[model samples]
Target: MSNFSNVSRRRFVKLAAASSGAVLLKGCLGNPPDTTATTAATVGSAALPAANVGTGETPEVTTIKLGFIPIVESAPLVIAKEKGFFDRYGMTGVEVSKQANWASARDNVVIGSAGGGIDGGQWQMPMPHLITEGIITNGNKVPMYVLAQLNTQGNGIAISGMNRQKGMGLKINDPEYVKGFERNQGRKFKAAHTFPNVNQDFWIRYWFASSGVDPDSDIDLLAVPPAETVQGMRTGTMDAFSTGDPWPYRIVADDIGFMSILTHQMWKFHPEEYLALRADWVDQNPKATKALLKAVMEAQQWCDDPANRQELVQICSGRNYFNVPSEVLTAPYEGKYALGDGKPEVNDFKAGPLYWKDDIGSVSYPYKSHDLWFLTETMRWNFHNGAIQDFDMARNLIDRVNREDLWLEAAKEAGFAAADIPTSTSRGIETFFDGVTFDPENPEAYLASLKIKRA
Candidate 1:
């Protein structure tokens, strides 16, 4: 059994209903947020069948242990519990646990969390090809798949305001200056990232690459966990780092590092953290798995409503979960940055997290080749040996982890009609925020287009 407690639905509804901020979430978020989005998203179908609401008699895991950190991206899991979405979908036995770090989150999933993490993202990267290649040699090798991209906004790059003033990547978009950034500095220009493979590393590398800095060669990077990022920024141990939520704002709150680049800058609505589960769990308890997905999806819709965000921030700030101050959690969500040096920037997005769209969230989960970009970085970062490896296995690993079919099923079960989500498996060009598109099927050309070499 997991150690965390379950949140009751009535309590969940009351909590959300009590908030005026949540009421303004819906339409307010749809337009690029001028001020914080101000419209509670509409519950598209009040006619949703309560019969479908309750989980049918299916074998359940009884206790599911999922992992996450204190960042805003993990709000859906927190809200799902608070909103009673978990119990509604037959995940009554579900319990949410906050791990100390991303590695702990990964370990919880790998070790099965009876003692530690059993299933979910633990502050780690995509393991490069781990999900796509199914490389679980250490423990029970369950094919791992994640459904639904939680945060497109959370993971981002920041630099000491000193460096921020220098316009590190943007001004130095020249490849040569990127390569010369560290040498240009009298001392090493240290950078920050959360865990190994996830957004911190990817965003850091992508940002570095954009500036022509070889993340591998140009600067020293410290893989500090999320909480430590701000302190590192404060102490000058790091010049900059890529991380999600709270930290950027925390550093900004304290006025240290300011937001430099974000995932949206890399690729619009790009996937950062995700809701992942072992492939074995899905195979054994399809009903329960689908129910879990449905519950979280519904919760995500609820949170995407701009109105619910303030309360969600408060909930996420509680001692039980993220345990951070509400100020830290809410800072990034509002697109406000408080660089310790006393500069602030308000970030706005046309597409933000969604309650429902043409049926995508502002932070909707879509599998794009941009996700696959991590694989080459895996090699570049020296995580994966330069194995041209088998693309078939690669595709399978991605398929196993993405579990798009399961995500769609959950959406349908949540009352979306079948056609509401893509049913066809055919992969195609994924449109990005920059209007640049990536086709998952044609990966090599994409890799070749970037002049950077494998690490």
Candidate 2:
């Protein structure tokens, strides 16, 4: 139904190359090639007994293959499995598949689980929208639904140790400091994100542009796997990288780099990654969709509990999950960071990754306004080359893909307090660290206020 058979010969070739790149990415990360994604649920105990849960309606399907990368954004999925949240909801067969890389995740989602790919799981902003519109799916429109945001404020921009004294913390401070990379160093400021034209890329681009440095022209910004990024930073081949937690902390721990800024400091409570799935699957199994949401929502609340921080860290750091030391995942949970290069240490619990709620409101709710901003930012950078024509088109796409209604249904059914459920789809205006405000109601004004953007 999604027309996978008609992909042009050229686009097919690109997909093949991307598949090869995924294998290369896994090797770069020192992970053995997983011909099939390993099942995360297999490492955890079976579902909780029904007595612990209010037996809601049974789901149409008990199993679904969901994919995730090793990042803080993926904690909810792992927790849902390891903590028996999925089992409590009668969704015992949910498989948390570890993706090789973002590109592989994208390609896998296009194929779907029946074809030996993922149905969907944790995804970066605009990815669900992009996949639905066929902009990034090799021209095959694989409609996706943005179910709920996984977490917020776990992302950071890492500056290689070589530029520790270049005044690159939080803000550029001086445009020439970054612009002089080619003159001072022998090359342009080489930077990368785990994926191109997404949340991580946007964070770094916003930080550079806020200080009057052009992201595209003033630096060489591209996509590189997280492990490759760290290695590049160590060898002085890469100047900076934008990615989610664990890597930012790893950079500091390995003495390869210092965090220029955590995303929490850039835009507090900013929307991060999300849980999405193939729209076809969701459509065919509505009860199962809500069941999945219920499980993840419960897990989010569990993840946010300070008392569960230690167990949460232990579960996420296991070999089947992030595969990093527990300490690498601990500080972000406690909101503690060394923040190398003489910068002051970060020591506030509110600064780390948040799942269920934040200082503002429900982090788990998939706000339509937040989706609009991601689309707007993608358009501002002219990502996908005019695929998103205008704000009106973006709003329409959000209407189709953002399943906030399903999230509300699941929350209410799961016995969430009325205060916890967001009353409105819009979170009002969002303000960034550089004093920029994004009024969701008026995206044109927000775009016009930007000094640097292709739009």
Best lDDT goes to which candidate? 2
CA shift of 393, model 1, Å: 3.2
Question: For this target, which candidate reaches the highest TM-score against the unseen true structure?
Answer: 2
TM-score of each model, paired residue for residue: 0.79, 0.88
Cα error of candidate 1 at position 292, Å: 0.5
> How many clashes show up per model?
46, 0
Q: Distance (Å) between predicted and true CA of 381, model 1? A: 4.9
| Model 2 residue pairs with clashes | none
lDDT values, one for every candidate: 0.56, 0.83
lDDT of 1 by residue, 1-455 (tens): 11111222232233323321221121212212222223334544322222244224454565577777766777778877776777655577787877777656655666575555566643344642364353423433446766666655555667775655454433243455445555776666777776655567776766666555777677787788655666666776667777666666666666675666555545655556667777676677887887777666667656655556788778889999888878776656665554433334545532233323322333444353334555545544556454425444445445445555566555544444333344233324555433434455665555555656574
lDDT tens readout by residue for model 2, 1-455 = 11111222234334333323211100000111232342222111322112223435889999999999988899989988887777767899999999999999999999999999999999999899999989998799999999999999988899999888878887877779779889988899899998888899999999999989999899899898888888999999998999888887888998999998999999999999999999999999999998899888778876777767888899999999999999998998999988898899999998999998888988999888899899999989999997899877887788788887777666655545555776667788999998999988788889999999999
- The C-alpha local distance difference test score for the whole of candidate 1 amounts to 0.56
In model 2, the runs with Cα more than 4 Å from the true position are 1-56
**What TM-score, to 2 decimals, does candidate 1 have?**
0.79
